[model samples]
Target: MEHKDNRYTISGTDIEEVKRKNGQSGMSYNEAIEWMAKTTGGRGTAIYSDTNMEEVKKQNQSVQDYNKNKA
Candidate 1:
């Protein structure tokens, strides 16, 4: 599924919760992407593909392989 660029807010309570969990708050788009990739075991670029579906799938598989081998 394609990921949408949804907006998220870092409220004071949210920030405090993040701090309690030793997490960082107030991330930009790029930062969120990196965080997602790190947290979910996938690449950030997979969410922003501009190529055709088949090519995107191929690239995504290649990236997954690369990431898996790098681990």
Candidate 2:
């Protein structure tokens, strides 16, 4: 997990590992929150608020822009 500003980014490998650990059933919402707290030193992402939403939007837009240019 990488923490910069208010964003928390977890890799697909990490998510797969979590799923594997949880018997492939996947984690519940609370389980994911606990994992984030433990893994990120208590700096869990605020799902209740708009934390990092802008960054996520910007990233998505960037990808769309890149694909448009490539095409």
Candidate achieving the largest lDDT: 2
Q: What does candidate 1's lDDT look like per residue over 1-71, in tens digits?
A: 43343332333244445555655446767777767765665654666434377887999999999999999
Off by over 4 Å in 2: 1-51
Candidate 1: stretches off by over 4 Å: 1-51
Scanning candidate 1 in windows of ten residues, the lowest lDDT window is 3-12
Spell out the clash pairs found in candidate 1: none
The positional error of residue 38 in candidate 1, measured at the CA in angstroms, is: 28
- lDDT by residue for model 2 (1-71), tens: 55453332343345555656778677888877767765664654554333476898999999999999999
Model 2 lDDT, full chain set: 0.66
Clashes of each: 0, 0
The weakest ten consecutive residues by lDDT in model 2 span 4-13
In angstroms, the error of model 2 at 62 is 0.2
